[model samples]
Target: MKNTLIESFVFLFERELDKLEAEIKQYPDEASVWKLEGDIKNPGGNLCLHLCGNLQQYIGEQLGHSGYQRNRPLEFSARDVSRAQLLNEIQKTKLVVSATLRKLDDESIRQMYPEEVLGYPMTTVFFLTHLLAHLGYHLGQINYHRRLIGR
Candidate 1:
Protein backbone atom coordinates (compact mmCIF):
# COMPACT_ATOMS: atom_id res chain seq x y z
CA MET A 1 0.00 0.00 0.00
CA LYS A 2 2.77 2.42 0.88
CA ASN A 3 4.68 1.63 -2.26
CA THR A 4 1.55 2.18 -4.31
CA LEU A 5 0.93 5.52 -2.63
CA ILE A 6 4.49 6.65 -3.28
CA GLU A 7 4.20 5.62 -6.89
CA SER A 8 1.03 7.67 -7.19
CA PHE A 9 2.77 10.77 -5.84
CA VAL A 10 5.68 10.30 -8.23
CA PHE A 11 3.19 10.07 -11.05
CA LEU A 12 1.48 13.24 -9.91
CA PHE A 13 4.70 15.17 -9.79
CA GLU A 14 5.73 13.97 -13.23
CA ARG A 15 2.33 14.88 -14.67
CA GLU A 16 2.49 18.37 -13.19
CA LEU A 17 5.98 18.83 -14.59
CA ASP A 18 4.70 17.90 -18.04
CA LYS A 19 1.85 20.40 -17.67
CA LEU A 20 4.25 23.13 -16.59
CA GLU A 21 6.58 22.44 -19.51
CA ALA A 22 3.67 22.54 -21.94
CA GLU A 23 2.48 25.85 -20.54
CA ILE A 24 5.94 27.31 -20.85
CA LYS A 25 6.22 26.20 -24.45
CA GLN A 26 2.74 27.45 -25.25
CA TYR A 27 3.35 30.95 -23.94
CA PRO A 28 5.43 33.51 -25.75
CA ASP A 29 8.68 34.62 -24.10
CA GLU A 30 7.30 38.07 -23.36
CA ALA A 31 3.99 36.70 -22.15
CA SER A 32 5.64 34.38 -19.63
CA VAL A 33 6.49 37.46 -17.57
CA TRP A 34 3.13 39.21 -17.98
CA LYS A 35 0.73 39.67 -15.09
CA LEU A 36 -2.98 40.15 -15.71
CA GLU A 37 -3.16 43.12 -13.35
CA GLY A 38 -1.01 44.94 -10.84
CA ASP A 39 -2.94 43.36 -7.99
CA ILE A 40 -3.08 39.97 -9.65
CA LYS A 41 0.34 38.84 -8.53
CA ASN A 42 2.64 35.97 -9.56
CA PRO A 43 3.39 35.68 -13.22
CA GLY A 44 4.02 32.26 -14.73
CA GLY A 45 7.78 32.61 -14.33
CA ASN A 46 7.58 33.32 -10.61
CA LEU A 47 5.03 30.54 -10.12
CA CYS A 48 7.36 28.09 -11.82
CA LEU A 49 10.17 29.21 -9.57
CA HIS A 50 7.94 28.86 -6.54
CA LEU A 51 6.93 25.33 -7.50
CA CYS A 52 10.52 24.23 -8.00
CA GLY A 53 11.62 25.79 -4.72
CA ASN A 54 8.69 24.36 -2.79
CA LEU A 55 9.28 20.79 -3.93
CA GLN A 56 13.03 20.95 -3.60
CA GLN A 57 12.85 22.40 -0.11
CA TYR A 58 10.13 20.17 1.30
CA ILE A 59 10.74 16.82 -0.36
CA GLY A 60 14.36 16.97 -1.47
CA GLU A 61 15.88 18.66 1.54
CA GLN A 62 13.65 17.57 4.40
CA LEU A 63 12.73 14.07 3.28
CA GLY A 64 15.68 13.04 1.16
CA HIS A 65 18.37 15.05 2.94
CA SER A 66 19.42 16.60 -0.34
CA GLY A 67 20.83 19.79 1.25
CA TYR A 68 18.73 22.13 -0.89
CA GLN A 69 18.85 25.70 0.34
CA ARG A 70 15.51 27.29 -0.35
CA ASN A 71 15.09 31.00 -1.00
CA ARG A 72 11.34 31.34 -0.69
CA PRO A 73 11.30 35.08 -1.22
CA LEU A 74 13.44 34.87 -4.33
CA GLU A 75 11.11 32.31 -5.80
CA PHE A 76 8.32 34.86 -5.83
CA SER A 77 10.47 37.89 -6.67
CA ALA A 78 12.64 36.72 -9.54
CA ARG A 79 11.57 37.79 -13.00
CA ASP A 80 12.27 37.34 -16.74
CA VAL A 81 13.79 33.88 -16.16
CA SER A 82 13.94 32.11 -19.50
CA ARG A 83 11.92 29.02 -20.36
CA ALA A 84 15.10 27.01 -20.79
CA GLN A 85 16.23 27.92 -17.28
CA LEU A 86 12.83 27.04 -15.85
CA LEU A 87 12.81 23.76 -17.76
CA ASN A 88 16.22 22.92 -16.40
CA GLU A 89 15.01 23.56 -12.88
CA ILE A 90 11.96 21.40 -13.49
CA GLN A 91 14.14 18.55 -14.72
CA LYS A 92 16.33 18.81 -11.64
CA THR A 93 13.28 18.79 -9.41
CA LYS A 94 11.96 15.71 -11.17
CA LEU A 95 15.20 13.87 -10.57
CA VAL A 96 15.22 14.87 -6.94
CA VAL A 97 11.65 13.74 -6.34
CA SER A 98 12.17 10.45 -8.17
CA ALA A 99 15.30 9.63 -6.25
CA THR A 100 13.80 10.61 -2.94
CA LEU A 101 10.65 8.58 -3.38
CA ARG A 102 12.60 5.60 -4.65
CA LYS A 103 14.63 5.58 -1.45
CA LEU A 104 11.59 5.43 0.82
CA ASP A 105 10.34 2.15 2.27
CA ASP A 106 7.03 1.50 4.04
CA GLU A 107 8.51 2.26 7.42
CA SER A 108 10.00 5.54 6.27
CA ILE A 109 6.80 6.60 4.60
CA ARG A 110 4.86 6.10 7.82
CA GLN A 111 7.39 7.93 9.99
CA MET A 112 6.66 11.42 11.29
CA TYR A 113 7.78 14.17 8.92
CA PRO A 114 10.94 15.93 10.11
CA GLU A 115 9.11 19.19 10.81
CA GLU A 116 5.61 20.51 11.27
CA VAL A 117 4.34 21.85 7.95
CA LEU A 118 1.39 24.25 7.58
CA GLY A 119 0.95 24.14 11.37
CA TYR A 120 0.25 20.42 11.54
CA PRO A 121 1.88 17.16 12.50
CA MET A 122 1.63 14.35 10.00
CA THR A 123 3.27 11.30 8.56
CA THR A 124 5.64 11.59 5.63
CA VAL A 125 3.05 10.11 3.35
CA PHE A 126 0.49 12.73 4.31
CA PHE A 127 2.89 15.59 3.83
CA LEU A 128 3.98 14.31 0.46
CA THR A 129 0.38 14.09 -0.74
CA HIS A 130 -0.22 17.62 0.51
CA LEU A 131 2.77 18.86 -1.44
CA LEU A 132 1.58 17.07 -4.53
CA ALA A 133 -1.77 18.82 -4.21
CA HIS A 134 -0.01 22.13 -3.77
CA LEU A 135 2.00 21.48 -6.90
CA GLY A 136 -1.16 20.73 -8.89
CA TYR A 137 -2.81 23.90 -7.61
CA HIS A 138 0.06 26.10 -8.77
CA LEU A 139 0.43 24.19 -11.99
CA GLY A 140 -3.21 24.97 -12.78
CA GLN A 141 -2.62 28.64 -12.02
CA ILE A 142 0.39 28.70 -14.32
CA ASN A 143 -1.60 27.09 -17.10
CA TYR A 144 -4.38 29.64 -16.71
CA HIS A 145 -1.98 32.56 -16.51
CA ARG A 146 -0.24 31.46 -19.67
CA ARG A 147 -3.48 31.01 -21.58
CA LEU A 148 -4.80 34.34 -20.37
CA ILE A 149 -1.71 36.37 -21.25
CA GLY A 150 0.05 34.40 -23.94
CA ARG A 151 0.29 35.96 -27.38
Candidate 2:
Protein backbone atom coordinates (compact mmCIF):
# COMPACT_ATOMS: atom_id res chain seq x y z
CA MET A 1 0.00 0.00 0.00
CA LYS A 2 2.77 2.42 0.85
CA ASN A 3 4.57 1.89 -2.41
CA THR A 4 1.33 2.32 -4.34
CA LEU A 5 0.39 5.33 -2.26
CA ILE A 6 3.71 7.06 -2.77
CA GLU A 7 3.67 6.38 -6.48
CA SER A 8 0.14 7.68 -6.79
CA PHE A 9 1.00 10.79 -4.80
CA VAL A 10 4.04 11.61 -6.92
CA PHE A 11 2.12 11.17 -10.15
CA LEU A 12 -0.86 13.26 -9.06
CA PHE A 13 1.25 15.99 -7.58
CA GLU A 14 3.20 16.30 -10.81
CA ARG A 15 0.03 16.36 -12.88
CA GLU A 16 -1.59 19.05 -10.76
CA LEU A 17 1.56 21.10 -10.72
CA ASP A 18 1.73 20.83 -14.47
CA LYS A 19 -1.84 22.02 -14.72
CA LEU A 20 -1.06 24.85 -12.32
CA GLU A 21 1.81 25.99 -14.50
CA ALA A 22 -0.39 25.81 -17.57
CA GLU A 23 -3.12 27.88 -15.90
CA ILE A 24 -0.65 30.57 -15.02
CA LYS A 25 0.80 30.52 -18.49
CA GLN A 26 -2.67 30.79 -20.01
CA TYR A 27 -2.99 34.38 -18.93
CA PRO A 28 -2.43 36.71 -21.85
CA ASP A 29 0.32 38.65 -20.09
CA GLU A 30 2.20 39.06 -16.83
CA ALA A 31 -0.15 41.80 -15.63
CA SER A 32 -3.12 39.63 -16.46
CA VAL A 33 -1.96 37.08 -13.92
CA TRP A 34 -2.49 39.74 -11.23
CA LYS A 35 -5.78 41.08 -12.55
CA LEU A 36 -8.55 41.13 -9.98
CA GLU A 37 -12.09 41.47 -11.30
CA GLY A 38 -15.68 41.52 -10.00
CA ASP A 39 -16.33 38.98 -7.22
CA ILE A 40 -12.76 37.75 -7.39
CA LYS A 41 -11.00 37.56 -4.05
CA ASN A 42 -7.52 36.42 -5.16
CA PRO A 43 -5.82 36.89 -8.46
CA GLY A 44 -3.96 34.12 -10.32
CA GLY A 45 -0.54 35.30 -9.20
CA ASN A 46 -1.40 35.07 -5.51
CA LEU A 47 -2.97 31.67 -5.97
CA CYS A 48 0.26 30.45 -7.52
CA LEU A 49 2.19 31.83 -4.59
CA HIS A 50 -0.15 30.32 -2.04
CA LEU A 51 -0.05 26.91 -3.72
CA CYS A 52 3.73 26.82 -3.91
CA GLY A 53 4.01 28.04 -0.34
CA ASN A 54 1.64 25.37 0.91
CA LEU A 55 3.47 22.52 -0.83
CA GLN A 56 6.93 23.77 0.04
CA GLN A 57 6.00 24.31 3.67
CA TYR A 58 4.14 21.06 4.23
CA ILE A 59 5.76 18.52 1.89
CA GLY A 60 9.13 20.10 1.22
CA GLU A 61 10.01 21.47 4.64
CA GLN A 62 8.08 19.38 7.11
CA LEU A 63 8.17 15.97 5.47
CA GLY A 64 11.31 16.38 3.37
CA HIS A 65 13.27 18.90 5.46
CA SER A 66 13.81 21.27 2.58
CA GLY A 67 14.19 24.20 5.03
CA TYR A 68 11.67 26.34 3.16
CA GLN A 69 10.30 29.17 5.22
CA ARG A 70 6.83 30.11 4.11
CA ASN A 71 5.42 33.62 4.52
CA ARG A 72 1.69 32.94 4.41
CA PRO A 73 0.66 36.57 4.40
CA LEU A 74 2.90 37.47 1.52
CA GLU A 75 1.47 34.65 -0.54
CA PHE A 76 -1.79 36.54 -0.71
CA SER A 77 -0.72 40.15 -0.40
CA ALA A 78 2.23 40.32 -2.78
CA ARG A 79 1.31 41.69 -6.15
CA ASP A 80 2.57 42.15 -9.72
CA VAL A 81 5.01 39.26 -9.58
CA SER A 82 6.18 38.35 -13.07
CA ARG A 83 4.67 35.29 -14.73
CA ALA A 84 8.17 34.06 -15.41
CA GLN A 85 8.89 34.07 -11.70
CA LEU A 86 5.61 32.36 -10.88
CA LEU A 87 6.30 29.69 -13.46
CA ASN A 88 9.74 29.20 -12.00
CA GLU A 89 8.24 28.77 -8.53
CA ILE A 90 5.88 26.10 -9.84
CA GLN A 91 8.76 24.21 -11.43
CA LYS A 92 10.80 24.37 -8.25
CA THR A 93 7.86 23.21 -6.18
CA LYS A 94 7.40 20.27 -8.50
CA LEU A 95 10.97 19.21 -7.95
CA VAL A 96 10.67 19.53 -4.20
CA VAL A 97 7.46 17.54 -4.04
CA SER A 98 8.80 14.83 -6.31
CA ALA A 99 12.09 14.46 -4.49
CA THR A 100 10.44 14.40 -1.11
CA LEU A 101 7.90 11.77 -2.00
CA ARG A 102 10.48 9.61 -3.74
CA LYS A 103 12.54 9.42 -0.57
CA LEU A 104 9.70 8.01 1.56
CA ASP A 105 9.03 4.34 2.26
CA ASP A 106 6.29 2.13 3.67
CA GLU A 107 7.55 2.26 7.24
CA SER A 108 7.98 6.02 7.29
CA ILE A 109 4.59 6.75 5.78
CA ARG A 110 2.81 4.50 8.27
CA GLN A 111 4.17 6.40 11.26
CA MET A 112 2.34 9.41 12.62
CA TYR A 113 2.88 12.49 10.55
CA PRO A 114 5.28 14.93 12.18
CA GLU A 115 2.80 17.79 12.32
CA GLU A 116 -0.55 17.71 14.13
CA VAL A 117 -2.55 19.54 11.50
CA LEU A 118 -6.00 18.92 13.02
CA GLY A 119 -5.01 19.35 16.68
CA TYR A 120 -4.46 15.60 16.77
CA PRO A 121 -2.10 13.18 15.13
CA MET A 122 -2.84 11.48 11.83
CA THR A 123 -0.90 9.11 9.68
CA THR A 124 1.51 10.62 7.18
CA VAL A 125 -0.48 9.19 4.32
CA PHE A 126 -3.67 10.86 5.52
CA PHE A 127 -2.06 14.24 5.74
CA LEU A 128 -0.56 13.79 2.30
CA THR A 129 -3.98 12.92 0.91
CA HIS A 130 -5.36 16.08 2.41
CA LEU A 131 -2.60 18.09 0.80
CA LEU A 132 -3.56 16.74 -2.62
CA ALA A 133 -7.15 17.84 -2.08
CA HIS A 134 -6.02 21.28 -1.02
CA LEU A 135 -3.97 21.59 -4.16
CA GLY A 136 -6.87 20.54 -6.35
CA TYR A 137 -9.33 22.96 -4.74
CA HIS A 138 -7.10 25.95 -5.35
CA LEU A 139 -6.20 24.75 -8.82
CA GLY A 140 -9.90 24.92 -9.63
CA GLN A 141 -10.04 28.42 -8.21
CA ILE A 142 -7.15 29.51 -10.40
CA ASN A 143 -8.92 28.07 -13.40
CA TYR A 144 -12.11 29.95 -12.66
CA HIS A 145 -10.20 33.13 -11.90
CA ARG A 146 -8.52 33.09 -15.29
CA ARG A 147 -11.86 32.61 -16.98
CA LEU A 148 -13.72 35.18 -14.89
CA ILE A 149 -11.19 37.93 -15.44
CA GLY A 150 -11.29 37.22 -19.20
CA ARG A 151 -7.64 36.32 -19.32
Candidate 3:
Protein backbone atom coordinates (compact mmCIF):
# COMPACT_ATOMS: atom_id res chain seq x y z
CA MET A 1 0.00 0.00 0.00
CA LYS A 2 2.82 2.40 0.86
CA ASN A 3 4.62 1.50 -2.33
CA THR A 4 1.46 2.22 -4.27
CA LEU A 5 1.31 5.72 -2.75
CA ILE A 6 4.91 6.43 -3.65
CA GLU A 7 4.37 5.31 -7.18
CA SER A 8 1.32 7.58 -7.38
CA PHE A 9 3.40 10.56 -6.38
CA VAL A 10 6.02 9.76 -8.97
CA PHE A 11 3.37 9.38 -11.62
CA LEU A 12 1.67 12.61 -10.59
CA PHE A 13 4.92 14.51 -10.81
CA GLU A 14 5.40 13.35 -14.36
CA ARG A 15 1.86 14.39 -15.26
CA GLU A 16 2.44 17.85 -13.83
CA LEU A 17 5.69 18.17 -15.74
CA ASP A 18 3.94 17.30 -18.96
CA LYS A 19 1.19 19.82 -18.21
CA LEU A 20 3.78 22.54 -17.67
CA GLU A 21 5.49 21.66 -20.94
CA ALA A 22 2.18 21.96 -22.74
CA GLU A 23 1.51 25.31 -21.11
CA ILE A 24 4.83 26.67 -22.38
CA LYS A 25 4.21 25.44 -25.87
CA GLN A 26 0.76 27.04 -25.98
CA TYR A 27 2.16 30.54 -25.54
CA PRO A 28 1.89 32.80 -28.57
CA ASP A 29 5.41 34.10 -28.31
CA GLU A 30 8.57 34.03 -26.23
CA ALA A 31 7.72 37.32 -24.52
CA SER A 32 4.53 35.68 -23.38
CA VAL A 33 6.69 33.26 -21.47
CA TRP A 34 7.66 35.99 -19.03
CA LYS A 35 4.24 37.61 -18.92
CA LEU A 36 3.38 36.55 -15.39
CA GLU A 37 3.10 39.59 -13.16
CA GLY A 38 3.30 40.48 -9.50
CA ASP A 39 4.80 43.52 -7.85
CA ILE A 40 6.93 44.01 -4.73
CA LYS A 41 3.82 45.12 -2.87
CA ASN A 42 1.79 42.19 -4.15
CA PRO A 43 4.60 39.71 -3.57
CA GLY A 44 4.03 36.83 -5.94
CA GLY A 45 6.72 35.22 -8.05
CA ASN A 46 6.27 35.03 -11.79
CA LEU A 47 5.27 31.69 -13.27
CA CYS A 48 8.47 30.97 -15.17
CA LEU A 49 10.96 31.55 -12.35
CA HIS A 50 8.65 30.22 -9.70
CA LEU A 51 8.13 26.90 -11.44
CA CYS A 52 11.79 26.39 -12.23
CA GLY A 53 13.10 27.49 -8.85
CA ASN A 54 10.52 25.54 -6.89
CA LEU A 55 11.19 22.35 -8.81
CA GLN A 56 14.93 22.80 -8.49
CA GLN A 57 14.63 23.35 -4.77
CA TYR A 58 12.34 20.38 -4.19
CA ILE A 59 14.35 17.95 -6.32
CA GLY A 60 17.68 19.07 -4.91
CA GLU A 61 16.49 18.92 -1.33
CA GLN A 62 14.96 15.48 -1.87
CA LEU A 63 17.96 14.02 -3.72
CA GLY A 64 20.36 15.33 -1.06
CA HIS A 65 21.64 18.28 -3.07
CA SER A 66 21.48 22.05 -2.44
CA GLY A 67 18.57 22.56 -4.88
CA TYR A 68 19.67 25.53 -6.99
CA GLN A 69 20.78 27.94 -4.26
CA ARG A 70 17.32 29.46 -4.15
CA ASN A 71 17.15 33.21 -3.74
CA ARG A 72 13.48 34.14 -4.08
CA PRO A 73 14.19 37.83 -4.42
CA LEU A 74 16.53 37.23 -7.33
CA GLU A 75 14.04 34.91 -8.95
CA PHE A 76 11.42 37.65 -9.05
CA SER A 77 13.92 40.35 -9.97
CA ALA A 78 15.13 38.67 -13.13
CA ARG A 79 14.23 39.81 -16.60
CA ASP A 80 12.20 37.83 -19.08
CA VAL A 81 13.86 34.80 -20.64
CA SER A 82 13.46 33.49 -24.16
CA ARG A 83 10.80 30.87 -24.80
CA ALA A 84 13.30 28.36 -26.13
CA GLN A 85 15.59 28.91 -23.17
CA LEU A 86 12.74 28.59 -20.70
CA LEU A 87 11.48 25.41 -22.32
CA ASN A 88 14.96 23.94 -22.27
CA GLU A 89 15.29 24.78 -18.60
CA ILE A 90 11.92 23.22 -17.83
CA GLN A 91 12.89 20.06 -19.69
CA LYS A 92 16.24 19.81 -17.98
CA THR A 93 14.74 20.31 -14.55
CA LYS A 94 11.99 17.76 -15.16
CA LEU A 95 14.57 15.21 -16.29
CA VAL A 96 16.62 15.75 -13.15
CA VAL A 97 13.58 15.40 -10.90
CA SER A 98 12.26 12.36 -12.75
CA ALA A 99 15.63 10.67 -12.56
CA THR A 100 15.77 11.25 -8.85
CA LEU A 101 12.30 9.81 -8.36
CA ARG A 102 13.22 6.79 -10.43
CA LYS A 103 16.00 5.96 -7.97
CA LEU A 104 13.80 5.73 -4.89
CA ASP A 105 13.35 2.24 -3.51
CA ASP A 106 10.64 1.56 -0.91
CA GLU A 107 13.29 1.66 1.77
CA SER A 108 14.41 5.08 0.61
CA ILE A 109 10.92 6.45 0.83
CA ARG A 110 10.48 5.13 4.36
CA GLN A 111 13.81 6.58 5.51
CA MET A 112 13.72 9.72 7.62
CA TYR A 113 15.41 12.84 6.35
CA PRO A 114 17.48 15.04 8.63
CA GLU A 115 15.87 18.30 9.73
CA GLU A 116 18.47 20.16 7.71
CA VAL A 117 17.43 18.26 4.61
CA LEU A 118 13.91 19.67 4.82
CA GLY A 119 15.03 23.08 6.15
CA TYR A 120 12.38 22.30 8.75
CA PRO A 121 11.15 19.24 10.58
CA MET A 122 9.30 16.90 8.24
CA THR A 123 9.18 13.22 7.50
CA THR A 124 10.24 12.11 4.03
CA VAL A 125 6.62 11.52 3.08
CA PHE A 126 5.62 14.98 4.27
CA PHE A 127 8.45 16.56 2.33
CA LEU A 128 7.36 14.75 -0.80
CA THR A 129 3.77 15.94 -0.30
CA HIS A 130 4.99 19.50 0.09
CA LEU A 131 6.81 19.34 -3.24
CA LEU A 132 3.80 17.89 -5.00
CA ALA A 133 1.49 20.58 -3.69
CA HIS A 134 3.95 23.36 -4.43
CA LEU A 135 4.45 22.21 -8.00
CA GLY A 136 0.70 21.92 -8.58
CA TYR A 137 0.17 25.46 -7.33
CA HIS A 138 2.81 26.87 -9.66
CA LEU A 139 1.38 24.94 -12.58
CA GLY A 140 -1.93 26.64 -11.91
CA GLN A 141 -0.14 29.97 -11.93
CA ILE A 142 1.41 29.14 -15.28
CA ASN A 143 -1.94 28.26 -16.72
CA TYR A 144 -3.44 31.50 -15.41
CA HIS A 145 -0.63 33.42 -17.09
CA ARG A 146 -1.32 31.53 -20.28
CA ARG A 147 -4.95 32.62 -20.21
CA LEU A 148 -3.95 36.24 -19.62
CA ILE A 149 -1.90 36.05 -22.80
CA GLY A 150 -4.90 34.44 -24.62
CA ARG A 151 -3.05 31.22 -25.35
Q: Model 3: runs farther than 4 Å from truth? A: 1-3, 36-45, 61-68, 116-120
For model 1, residues 1-151, the per-residue Cα lDDT tens digits are 3347677777778888888877777787654555655465988889889999999999899988999999999998887777789889989998998889878876788999989977888999888888888988988888878777754
Candidates' C-alpha lDDT: 0.83, 0.92, 0.68
Ranking by lDDT: 2, 1, 3
What is the lDDT, from 0 to 100, of the residue 85 in candidate 3? 72
**For model 1, where is the 10-residue window of minimal lDDT?**
30-39
Candidate 3 lDDT tens digits, 1-151: 2257557766887788788878888877777666545532211225656677776776655464745677767667776666677678678777777677677766676666555555666666677787788888878867777776663
What is the total number of backbone clashes in candidate 3?
Answer: 0
What clash pairs does model 1 have? none
Candidate 2 steric clashes: 0
Best-fitting candidate, measured by lDDT? 2
Cα RMSD (angstroms) for every candidate in the order listed:
2.0, 1.7, 3.6
Q: Model 3, residue 104: displacement in angstroms?
A: 1.7
Writing each residue's lDDT as its tens digit, candidate 2 over 16-125 gives: 99999999988877878898888887998999999999999999999999999999999999999988899999999999999999999767888999989778999998
Model 2 regions lying over 4 Å from their true place: 1-3
Candidate 2: worst 10 consecutive residues by lDDT? 1-10
